[model samples]
Every structure is written in structure tokens, then in C-alpha cells.
Target: MKDENIKKVLLLGSGALKIGEAGEFDYSGSQALKALREEGVKTVLINPNIATVQTSEGVADQIYFLPVQPHFVEEVIKKERPDGILLSFGGQTALNCGVELYRQGILEKYNVKVLGTPVQAIMDTEDRELFVQKLDEINVKTIKSEACENMEQTRKAAAELGYPVIIRAAYALGGLGSGFADNEEELVKLAEKAFSFSPQVLVEKSLKGWKEIEYEVVRDRYDNCITVCNMENFDPLGIHTGESIVIAPSQTLTNSEYHKLRALAIKIIRHIGIVGECNVQYAFDPQSEDYRVIEVNARLSRSSALASKATGYPLAFVAAKLGMGYGLFELKNSVTKTTSAFFEPALDYVVCKIPRWDLSKFRGVDKELGSSMKSVGEVMAIGRNFEEAIQKGLRMIGQGMHGFVENKELEIEDIDSALREPTDKRVFVISKAMHKGYTVDQIHDLTKIDKWFLEKLQHIIDIDEAMKKCNINTLDKELLRTAKVYGFTDFQIARAVGLEDELKSMRKASLVVRSRRKNYGILPVVKQIDTLAAEYPAQTNYLYVTYAGVKSDITFENDKRSIIVLGSGAYRIGSSVEFDWCGVQALNTIRKEGYRS
Candidate 1:
């Protein structure tokens, strides 16, 4: 039954901004809608989150304020009679809702075809053990793992695999109920927590301190596939990529290793038959740098936002067009303005993302980062040279001209000792190393970031030391702006200035982030990460990644606009602090863009 007049799409959107499932889906879902509308396709979006830009009426042909439940989506399905349903945009919530719709026979009863992936494909990729089996069939190097339903099963599995296993509760989000436990006691504690999250759990060898890499791949109905962008996390394999400070195009992978992982990404997408978009995560041994496949998310994810923003590829847009049977070649490059859709994005410079944590307010939550990630937001920085980019990124984070200020007064801590154990304050450890007069080369050998970036931060530290030693008060606005970018609070500045009211005014005026039109037309203020609830299972999480810009139509309150670079999201008890650094960056970027601080 090939209906020739298929022009409408039904979108299942992530609902509210709850704990586990927060706002990133809103960005992807919003982008998908914009892409569809650009192609003149009618879009019917059903989401309960009113705060999101996607739920707006103009973004879609028809908007519905509905729960993600299958029955509710089915009702929209019956009324709108869409040509097909797109489950690719929204996060796991939409996928699960589609699963229910198919299971309840609503989609079947209505004869509505699933657009991007069929019901069977979703089931195959989502079921952890099933996905692993499929990957094994393809000879992919997955971790030795098992799905256990109870305490007895967990013990038996641990005994066979040996101790110090990684436990992940099936269907849990953001590493909830996941940890590295050594021996019976720790295993029992982790198992209890995991099983509590879900009846089934996955136990495998813990691969901590390994190299963590993420790939964004897209495919079409014609079986043509292309790798869009690849990212590497600064934190070793054990930490979740989301919670790590990530750099795009990997600063350290040998060309061969990078290609090897890219090939695997293509193969997995083909095997799973994901037509539109997918994310593949890989873990590599730090010593040998050996690569092993982690899990393949069969839908758009947070990384997709970073990938799209970094590459200017518009992944969500191409994916939506692909779902409508448009081949990859038919979709043009949005950023490069190229006609060739087969080409992958190549970076002219480096892009880094520091995960922002909301844990500053919590007590005894263990600031240590680990095999699991616990950050709520992230910030991206770009540089032509590593050091300048590091400084720029630091400034972008509103951390007081971060890498530009010299003589970083650090509370010296041993980095290797810190790395051996994960902490929520890992960035501080990196900062402390720089403050200790460790050369950038030395830092790179230890931390795995480009030496170029380290050198830039070191330059800032050098400058600061000179300023303090010589009492150089080069009191220019530009100098002040640079200082502010590096994370210098007015209190700290006040310490140097002996001006309490000046510092107080600086805090009150508080910086706000605004975007300027880049030469490439990419808005600097791109999006947000809502990970406060990413760790829950089969629950809802919504993250919003929006473009912050201006019409040049200005209004002033007391001749000053109250602006605060909204941090990525709330740093829950388990989330880390890099995202706060991200918020710091955002504040600086706003000031740099000429917005009032």
C-alpha cells in the first residue's frame, strides 16, 4: 500500500523537564521539526513540555499538548492521520512510547507505518542482551557481560567472570544503578541498587581508565551510510562521555585507530538497520589503546547536538529527510553549503566540551568522578591552536579569561593519584596541575589533552603570576574582560583591588550570555544539557539546546540588563562540576560578545 500523498509526520516528543529525562531531546526534536518544515512537510508534535521551543505552533504544522503514552499518541494518530510517525527525534521516552503503541496494537490497528525504524528494529537494539548478541554475531568486541535478574544470578555471574565487574541495570539512564565493584560485598551493594532500578542488570568486567570515544553515524533507506563526527573524552574510559571533558576529532588517536572505530560504526548501523541517525560509543584500553564497542543508541542523543553544532552538518535535519526516503546524497551540507552529502565533516580547529556539574550545592555526594558519569550540562570551546582555543574556551566559560590569566594559584594536588580515583572535581585536578608549574607537555603526557591547550592555560598562569608579582594594574576593559573569562570572581578580584563595593557590583550586575552571528552563521549560544535525570530507567528526561541570539532591538533595565549565563542544568547530588565551568564559560562568552555582564 504505497500511499503517494505522504507528506505529514507525527512526532513523539519528550514530555516534561523531570529528573532522569531532561531537555536535550527538545533540541533534537525541535531541529527535526524545523528541517521537516523547510522541506514543506507537515509536522504534528505531541509533547507536554511547554517551555521548549519545539512545542511552539509555528515550528510544527500542528502541535498537541499530550502525554507520551501510546493511547494518547494513537489518538493524535487517528485524528491527524499522518503519513508516518518519526520516533527518531525525542529521547528514550518517545522510543518507549512507540514500543507501547506497537505492543498495544494501536499503530497496528490504525495501519500507521513507523517511519525511521520498524517496531522489530527498536526491540532488537534496545534489549541489552539482544543487542549484545547481535553485535557478537557481527564479531564486534563487546565487553564480556551478562544480564542478571536477581542477587543469586549476580553472584553466580561475578564468580564466573572473576571479581571487579561493572554492573549496569538494564534500561537505566545516565549510569543509574551502575558501578565498578570489586569482590562480593561491593558487588552485592551495586547489584541491590541496580536491581532496584530494574528487574534485570548487566554485569561485565570493569574497563576503567580506558579511552572513551563516541561516533555519530547516519544512514538512509538506500543503505548508504556516512560517519558525521567523532569525539574523544579527556577522562579515561571509566567515566561516562557525557560527564567528561570531550574534544572532537580526537586529539590523540593514531589515524589507524580512528579509522578502525569509524568502520565499526558503519558496520553496526548497517547491521541494526538504523535508517536515519544513531550514536556509537567505544572504549579503548589506555595502555594498548585497544578499542571495544560499548553500546549503540539507535536514536538521536545529546552527542548528536554537539556533533551537529561542531560540524554544521544538521544531523537531525538530514535524518528527517532520510526518513522520508530521501537518500543521503539528496541532502546537502547545511554548514559547508556543499552539494555533496556523502562527505564527513572535517574540522579546521579543535573543539572541546567540559561537562558541567550541579553538585556544588550538595554535601557528601563524593565529588570524585568515576566509571559512571554524573554531570548535568556541558560547554563547547573552539581553537585554531590548542592553547589559544583553551584560553578562548576558558573565557567562554565565564571563568575570568580562564587560560589567559597567568600564575594560577592552585591548591596543589597530585594528578596521577587523583586520576587513579574518579572525582566530581577532576577539572580542578587538571587546573591544580597547571598551577603547580607543570609544563603543558608534562600535563598532556598525563591528562591526554592536546599540549597546545595546556600551553595556553600555562600562558594565562604565567601572565597572572607576573601581574601579582609586579602588581601590574593594566586596568583596561579588555584586560578586565579577559580576567573575568578565566573564572575570577569579583571576590577574588576584590582581594587584589581592596574594593568591596566594586566586587559586589560585579556580582550583582552578573554576566549574561548572548550570541553573535559567526562568520559561518552559526550562533555562538547553541544549546543546553538536561542530565539531572539521565540515569533513570524507562523514565522521562528532556534537555533543551537552543540558539541564543538578538534582533538588535534592545531594552534596558536601569540602563543594564540582568543576565546570567544559565548553567547547563541543576547539578544534582551525583552530577559533577565541569558543567559549572561550562556556565562560567557561557557567562564569559556573553561579555565577549558585548552583552552586559
Candidate 2:
């Protein structure tokens, strides 16, 4: 009873903002919907969260503000008789629901084909014990670990394994339902909380202080695989990669490590049958430089957005086409009209991403880095040089944006301390460090950023500090001289030195015209990393801190309408919608491109 005429799609979306699930899936799902529409395919989206811009007038042909569950999704499929259902666009909730329906013959009943990866592949990747077994066969190095379902079982596994293990609740994100435990008592308390996220938990040796690295890989049905980009987090092993200041093209990597990861990424994607996009996180122990697999998101993710923006590749759109049986090399490129889909982009510059953290509200949580992600949004800067990239990132997140130092409500001292923490805001702290009396060299050593950039930051800080001590409240001749040397405008120096009146006067003055301050190149610019930036520009002055290599020359000669949605920044408060904002713009752009149901 399978219909050869299957073309319409049913997209499952994760529900609204909640403790466990949030809007990121809506963003990705929205992207897929628009992409399908571009190929003249009808789309039906099922998501309970009506607030998303994706549910608005033109994003999809059929929008059902219904819960994404086995029962409801099956009902829609049976009624609408869509050709396929896409679980990859949705988050874990939708993926899990799709699996449940497939297992129960719900999909078979309607003769619906599941788009993206197959159900068995999803199960093999998710079921920890089975996954580990598969990995063992493949010779992928995993940490010493055990999976347990209950407290007593976990205790038995922990006792046999050892104390001071890492306990992570299954299927949780942002390090939710995850923690470090030293003793049996601590383990019991932590496990109790972790249980809320999933029924099974994984306890493994904590890979603290290791180098955290991520690789975003894309594959197509023809088994054509390519690693889009690699990002290295500033924070060490314990902290989540999203919460760290991440740089692409690995500032410190043995050539072999980089290539090995690239090779391994290809292998894993091919093995898992992931015929679209996936993000793989790893922990490299610095002492031995040994690597261990952290986890993999077998779908479009926040990392995918960052990588897409960083690399200049349209990952989401390409993935949709992959689901349609187009190979990476055969599909039409989206950027460079002359190039074929076969060419994997080669980057000539570095890209850095500084995640934006909203720790200004959470006074109690230690701002120091941790295993879980807590970034609300991230800023991207692009530059040819590391120093320029670093500086650009600082300026992008500062002064004007409420998320950073420009947050007028927060005290300078508090801001200073916030910077001192290993959170994503560390670059701003480094910028402030110049005024705090730390030398450029010392700041570089502390933050692990480049030295050339550190010197410039020190100069900026020195000028501000000098102006503050001089008590030059208004436009002073000496202050201006130093400001020029420190690369600060009169207003910036005045703001630093508490010269509000002088800054106002300087702004009002016609004789001294101050040009726009260029972004300090603190973060990396990806030419091809995030597809969101390619389809559009930032509405507000909010630019992501990415490196110069942040764009990709996509090859598209035909006028095929497509979209790229940004995923929510690793999952933090306040800045969470940064991904959503990108997604919203992508949807708009797709509609503008004449993509319709």
C-alpha cells in the first residue's frame, strides 16, 4: 500500500520553553519545513508551542499546534497521509516519539516513510549499552563506563567501577541531570536528581581538565561525508563546549589529532547511517593527548548552526536535500554558483565564537566553568589574525548589547568578577583585565588566547586606567592622545574614566568626528559555519563572534528557495533565543525566495 507519489512531509517539533525541552527544535524543524517547500513539497508541522515565528502565516502549508507525541503525530500522519516524517529536525523528544511510533507499527499503518536516518540507527546510537558495544566493535576509544537503571544498580556499578565518577542522566542536555560525585552519599543525591531527566544513567570516569573539541559532520544517502568544521573550547574538559570561548581550526592541535578527528568523523557518520547532519563532541586528555568520545547529536544542533556560520556552508538546507537522496557532491551548491557540490570547502582563515552568558542574574551559581552548558547566546567575530578576532569578539559583546559590559544595571566590580570566571564571557574580562593592571602577556597566559591580541588589549586597558586616574572628566588633550594609542574612541575612554559629560560633548562636537569603532577581532570568523548568517544579516547590531573563514561559497545556479534556522545557544537563560532569532530570519528569507507549499 506504499504510495510512490509520497512527497508531503510531517515535521515533528519539540514543545515550548520548558525545564527539559525548549525552542531549538522548533528552529531546526522550521528550517526543514521551508526547505521542503522549496522543492514544491507540501509540509505539515506539529508543535504545541504556538509562539514560534515558524507557526506564522507562510512558513508551512499545514501547521498543527498539537503536542509532539506518538499518539498525536500518528493521528496527523494517518489523516494527512504525508509521504514522510522527519525526526532529525526535531530534538530528542520528537526523535524518541518517532522511534516509539515506528516500533508500534503506527508509521507502518499509514505507510509513511520516515525521513532522515532510519529508526534502527537511531536506537543503536541512543541506547548507551548497545552504542558502547557498537563502538567497541568499531575500535572507538570510549571512557570506562557503566549504565544502570536504578539507584541500587548504579551503586553496584559504581562500587565495582570506582568512586568519584561522572554521573550523567541519559538523554539530558546542558549537563542537566549530570554531576560529579565523590562518595556514595553524594552519588545517591545526584542520581536522584539525574533520574528526573531519563530512566537510565551513565557513570563513567570523569575526564576533567581534558581539551574539549567538537566536529560537525554532514552526510548524504550516497555515503558522501565531509567534516564541516572543528571547534576547540577555551574551557577545559569539565566545562561544556557551548559555555566555553570556542575557536575553529584548533589553535593548539597536533596535526595528527586534527586529521584523525576528521577521519573518525567520516567513519562514524558512515557507520551510523546518519544521512544528514550531526555534531560529535570529544574530550582530549592533555597529559596523554588521548581522545575519548563525549557524545553525538544525530541531528541538526546548536553546534551545527555555529559550524554552518563559521564555515559558510548551508548545512540545514544541504541536509534536507540529503534526506531527498541527493549526495553532497551531486547537489547544487548554495553560495558559489559555478562550483559543483563535490568540493568540500577549504578555509584560509580562522573563526572564533564567544558564547554570551546571562550570569548577571544568577548570583549564586559559580561562574567558573562546569560540565554543563549555560550560555544564553553567542557572539561571532571574523578576522585574518587571532588578535583581531579576539578584539572583534570583545567589542561585539560589549557596550551596546545588554548581555555584556554595556549592561548599565550591573556594577563594574561585578562585571569585572564575571569576566574573571571561565564562563563564555571571559574575553570581556580579558578586555577589562588591561585596566585591572594585568599585562598583555599575563592575560594571554591566563585566557590561553594569542599574545599579539593580548598586547593590544593591555594598551586599551592602560589608556582607560590612565584616564581614570588623571580625573580628566571632559575632553582632555592628553586623554585623546592616549585614547588614540589604545585604540579607544573619546567616548570609550570617557566612559572608562567616568567622564560622562565629556563623552556627551565629544559625541555632540562637530570638529572631532569619531568614526565607527571596528570590532576587536577577539573571536574567529567562519566563512561557512552558520547558514543563518548567509541567508540574511543581523536585524539589530548583534553580530556573532566568528572568524573570517565563517562563510562558504555555496554553489547554487538554479533559483531553489532554501532556509537556515539557528539553534538556541547551547541552552541558557536570556540569550537563548539567539538561535531562534536566526531561525526566524531564515524562515522569512525562505518565504522571500518564493518557497511555498
On lDDT, the leading prediction is 1
After superposition, the stretches of candidate 2 with alpha carbons farther than 4 Å from their true spots are 1-5, 18-24, 362-369, 395-597
Per-residue lDDT over 545-567 for candidate 2, one digit per residue giving the tens place of the 0 to 100 score: 23234343333345555444545
**Candidate achieving the largest TM-score:** 2
In model 2, the number of clashes is: 70
Model 1, runs deviating above 4 Å:
1-5, 18-21, 371-373, 398-401, 404-419, 437-597
lDDT of 2: 0.66
lDDT of 1 by residue, 489-541 (tens): 33334333433344455443222111111222433232222111122111111
Candidate 1 lDDT at 535 equals: 27
The weakest ten consecutive residues by lDDT in model 1 span: 531-540
